[model samples]
Target: MSLLTVRNLNVNFAQRQQPIEALLDINFSIEPGERLAIVGESGAGKSLLGAAITQLLPKPGYIASGSVTLRGKELTQLSPKQWQEVRGQRIAMIFQDLMMTLNPVLSIGAQMVEAIRSHTRIGYKDARKMAIEKLAQVRIASPSQRFEQYPHELSGGMRQRVIIAIVLLLRPELIIADEPTTALDVTIQAEILQLLKEVCESHGVALIFISHDFGVVARISERTLVMYAGKIVEQGATLEIINDPQHPYTQGLLNALPQMALPGQRLNQITGNMPSPSERPSGCAFHPRCRYATERCSQEIPSFINTDVSIAACILLEELVSHEEEPDV
Candidate 1:
């Protein structure tokens, strides 16, 4: 059975003028020990999806439709107290901003002790020992001394590591990591990703890693979901999507990636900005920027078409592939 299942989920925010649809019919599932990555541009609802799963959406934003189930229990219907029990215990999260997640005034040891004690009834001494062990697990140097330091005293990478350590100490069944390495250097980012992958693998923890960087997603995820304007446009095994993207939007994003070519070669870029929530076009949200868009594409939404290892919400895949394989015109 899937560890976490999100079906036909929709999230909306109320505004003075109109209701902003933040997520529309989002659907996906993560199997036990599976590492899934949700990749998209900014405003693609990646972070919003994470918040929805954790039941942490801000006021005025609410789940308008569908269900979120973790271990066969419906999360949406859970009471506040039930949510508290499920959140840090069964489903922990490593938020996007480490500094925001950490308490600036509290020592790392204090926060870690609290997290460890929150779910399990443990004495301060036992919790402190677990905290130190977790800090070492995330590769924090001089874990003993570092545990006594405040968030401000630690470097950016160290702080991120600490946040990760806390989540791992919980040993939750599922973890929703929202851009966990956003604030770290490239080298540190690699280390963090590696640590997360190792932990999830060893503990059979399901991971939903959300990020806008395809390279980062490709590195740590076995499966990938490409989201656009709050909906999934393409999804499949990471290798399949990366090597053979079918959706026009996915193709455009892959094209926009910087290449290690000659200095004079121009880099590819996707033209056109994403539409605002209030001004989202009818039919396919990506129609305006899609190169293969037809008259029908602008008038009707395309259904997801399965392609063995991948699924794409595009009307022109077959034609596009046929044309690509054709000889010179």
Candidate 2:
């Protein structure tokens, strides 16, 4: 059975006029010890999907419909108390901002021990020992000494390591890392990615790595979901999508990668900006910005179609398949 399954998950922002759909018909699954990346631009609902899975959506945002299941258990049906039991014990999230994720007033040991105690009835001393060990496991130097320091005292990379350590305290089955290395320098980013991948592999943990950069996604995840506006535009193996993208949006993203640029040339970029939920265009939300969009694209919503390389939601792919299937004269 899949470790995690999200079926038609819809998230909406409550508004007096009408509910704004933040996520639409999101569906995907993850297997045990597998790593999947949700890739898209800002407001593409990558983080929102993460929040929906963890039941941590921001104020006014809620799951309008659909289900989030973990190990055959339906999370959407869980009550507040039940959710508390499932959160740290089964699923944990690593936010991008370390400062916001870590408490300024609490020492690293204090925060970790508190988390451990909240999920399990361990003694403070035992929790502290476990916390320190976890810190060391993430390769933080001087773990025991660093445990007593506050978040402000650590560097960005070190703080991220602490966050990972805290998430590992509960030995969660799945970790949702929401751009955890975005704030760090390039070298630190690579280190954290390597550490996160190694930690998950060592622990036999599944991961949902949310990122906008294809480069990072390629490094950390085996599969990739390309999200646009509020829907998945493409889904397939990471290397497949990176090497041979079927959807225009996915192709545009890979094309924009630095490695794709010629030396001294300006980096490529996709034309236009992502549309907001409230301002999403009819038919295909991405139609307005899609260079390959046709008149039909603006009038009819595209459905996902399977290609040799990936599953993509675009009429161009559908038409290509149709033409190929037609009998020749």
Candidate 3:
């Protein structure tokens, strides 16, 4: 059985005027110990997907129609009380901003111990020992000394590592990381990625890494899902998508990477900003910015088509498939 399955997931915002769809027809499955990456622009509904899965959506946002099953247990149907039992223990989340995630007043050890004891029957002393061990596991030197330090006392990278250690305290089956390395320096980001990859593998934990950078996820995830304007435009093996992206948006993203640029040449850029949910264009949401878009693209939403290399939702791919299948005279 899949570790997690999300089918026909739709997230909507309740507005006084009318309900606005934030996520539409989202579908995917993650296997046990597998790592998946959700990559897209800032407004592509990446973080919203994570929030919906974890039942942490902000006010006015709610799952409208869909099912989220984790290990055969339906998560969307769980009550707040039931969710408390599952969260942290079964599914932990590591956010991008460590300062916001870590309490400024509480010492690292206090928070870790509280989290451990909240989900388990362990006493304070045992929880403290476990927390220190986790801190050490994340490669924090002098774990005991760092345990007493407040959030402000640690660097950004250290705080992120602490967050990872806390996420490990319960040995969660899955970890939803939302751009955990975005705020760190390049070197620190690389180190954190490697550490995260290793830790998840060693713990046998599935990971859903959310990020806007395709390059960043290349080193961590085995599969990639490309989202755009609240829809999944493409999905396939990580290396396959990186080497031969089937969707225009995915191609544009890979092109914009710094590594894709030649020596002394300006990096390629995808023109136009992502559309807002409230003002999303008609038909294929990406048609407005898609260079290959035709009049038909603006008039009809494209359903996902098998592209051999990757599954993608685009009319161009459909045309290509049809053309290739036609026999020559």
Q: List the residue pairs that clash in candidate 1.
A: none
lDDT of 2 by residue, 1-329 (tens): 99999999999999998999999999999999999999999989999999999998999999999999998999998899999988888899999988999999999988999999988889998998899899989999999999999999999999999999999989999999999999999999999999999999999999999999999998999999999999999999999988899999898898899989999999889989999899999988888888999999999999899998999999988899999999999
Q: What is the TM-score of each candidate against the true structure?
A: 0.94, 0.98, 0.98
TM-score of 3: 0.98
Residue 89 of model 2, lDDT score: 83
Which segments of candidate 1 are over 4 A away from where they belong? Answer: 16-18, 260-266, 318-329
At residue 273, give the lDDT of candidate 3.
Answer: 93
lDDT tens digits by residue: candidate 1, 1-329: 78899999999998898789989999999899999999989988889999999889999999999999987889999999989889877899888777789999899999999988878899999999999998998889999999999999988888888987898887889888999898788898998899889988988988999998887887899999999988998999998988888888988878777762356888677778877777788888888987778888888887888776598888786555567779996
Query: Best candidate, lDDT-wise?
Result: 3
> Which sequence of candidate numbers ranks them by TM-score, best first?
3, 2, 1
